[model samples]
Target: MKFRVKKATKNRTCIVSAAPYHPYQRCKAQGHVEFFSDFNKDSLFGVITFYQHKYENKVIVDGIFTTDIGIDGIKTSDGRPRYTAELYNEDEEMIFDLTSAVFNNAIQLVSIKKELINLEICGDEGIIGKAVVLKRGGEEIARAEVYRLDPIV
Candidate 1:
């Protein structure tokens, strides 16, 4: 059997070319959720999108694509409710995924401590790498890049 491949468009992060079955519909119908804690003990959940693809003649999944921001629920000292901006990605197989949680609310707060973001990539040799960033907002976050160093070795 022959296969057709296409590059991802500017607006499209992931491109699904010719396949035995359709994967877009399957991903759209399914939703993956993740929960994380902020510095102040506030909780947030991220809903991820899952998709299936043909990699190296084998069926593999590109799981859980999301942005850095998850839920937009914030709290106020006066017992009021505040909403933050929501972040989303257009490309299903985009390069990065980020999630953040807020800590002590302070004016001119440049950064806070939070959980790491998750990144996944399917290499050309049928190897998959998953990475995570640990730190808060801004720079100085601990990042762990994982992948098979050498398949041939």
Candidate 2:
């Protein structure tokens, strides 16, 4: 997917994770995540894949996501703007808040950095979640629903 990233300002920093949140917990199983627009369930926003594991001695989850949304347009109170995806369960309880990954291209539309990773949204079922574009103060501008695809094995 093509994405546009605004020019990176001086001191613009991107957060990258080098290790799993739960370094000690062994991954037991794997699952898939795909997002759809809230307005229309059939409209797909993107896909995220997660692994079942534990963090800080308690069970937790993390995943990687990719989409077509433009990243640089997002605003923040501080000069450091970022995007995030919030995942919820069937009960409408939020399970995870993911920070959008950093993109490398500053001049034009790029493809690789649109992929986000290591989103630590916690839940047991690993069935579904939601994606949204939040205004600086936490207002929703665009939103999508998360769905787990059936495993092949």
TM for every model, in the order presented, reads 0.23, 0.37
TM-score of 1: 0.23
Worst 10 residues of 2 by lDDT: 100-109
Q: Pick the candidate with the highest TM-score.
A: 2
TM-score, cand. 2: 0.37
Error of 2 at 40 (Å): 11
Which runs of model 2 end up more than 4 angstroms from their true locations? 1-46, 53-71, 74-81, 100-124, 129-136, 151-153
Query: Quick one: best lDDT, which candidate?
Result: 2
lDDT of 1 by residue, 64-151 (tens): 2112343234334553323232223333233433332222221113334323323223334221333333333433223333333222
C-alpha positional error of residue 14 in candidate 1 after TM-score superposition, expressed in Å: 38
**Per-residue CA lDDT of candidate 2, range 1-153, in tens?**
333344567888655545435335444444444444453222224444554434432323333332344333432345343345565556666655543432122212343433334443345533445443322246453455544444356
* Clash numbers, per candidate: 3, 2
